[model samples]
Target: MSSSDRLLLILHIGFAIFTLGPLTAATMATPRFIRNQNLVVVRYLNRTTRIYGIGTLGIFLFGLFLASGDFAKPWLSASMTLFIVALVLLLIVERDQRKAAHLLETAAAKAAPAASSTKTGGEGAEEGEKAEKAKAAKPAAPGADIAQVERGRIAAMSGVVALLWLVVLVLMVWNG
Candidate 1:
């Protein structure tokens, strides 16, 4: 290969590693954090998702630069299609993470008042019994249930993205 081709190939690989690796890690961590109701980690993962979203552009641009000479290759076309699909999956995962974070935040807010009231020892015995019964009578929060479902979706989608990346890597290495 020529020097320019070599440089582009190197940059493409570098961006792929830098962008996809952390993105996968963050995406994987997101569901766990959401399951734990750890909003802090969920928010951090969301930020990581955004950062890698920009990094994905670098991967795409560098990949296009490297593929310019062989744009007609079937493998390249397939890889491009897979990359686009993976990007869409990543965006969906990111959106789910944001939703999970919001849900956790709202759950925390709703619990705060009850926690503070209990800590202050302000309620009499009958009132305390009523409060406890009221809490028990409340249905499961929809946010928590939705967040759990979203986390499962994110995990499944992230796995598909990883598999797509693996296929792309194989195509590039063996068929490019």
Candidate 2:
């Protein structure tokens, strides 16, 4: 391999590790935080997913450079196709994260007013506590169930994206 190709290979590998790894982790962890109604962490992970998702483009670009426009190689073409599919999946996952976060925020906003209304100096303290317990035991509010579905979808899609990355990596190592 030429010096430039070697450099490109190193950069491709570096981006794959730095970007894809975090992207996978962020997507996987997002559903759990969304399920827990941790909006802050979910937003953070969403941002992380976006950043790393963009960073993954570097891996593709560098690999393309390393390939030197030799698109005839079956493994190279297959890896490229899989990588594109993974990017599409990640984009969908990102959108789902945003939707889940919005749902959580909406639920929290609706609950906040109800919670404040329940407060009546010290008079309704016991009643408020009981209400809170009952509320906890009650079925999820309208948007909450949708958020739960989003979380499940995010988890499943993220898993599929991660599997695509693994398949691409295997193609690189096994067929290259």
TM-score, one value per model: 0.84, 0.89
Best by TM-score: 2
Each prediction's whole-model lDDT (CA): 0.84, 0.87
lDDT of 2 by residue, 1-176 (tens): 88888888889999999998888999999987876677899999999999999999999999888888799999999999999999999899999999988888888888878866885657678888888787766534554564878899899999999899999999999987
- TM-score result, candidate 1: 0.84
C-alpha RMSD values across all candidates: 4.6, 2.7
Candidate 1: deviation at residue 79, Å? 0.2
Best lDDT among the predictions, by candidate number: 2
Clashing pairs in 1: none
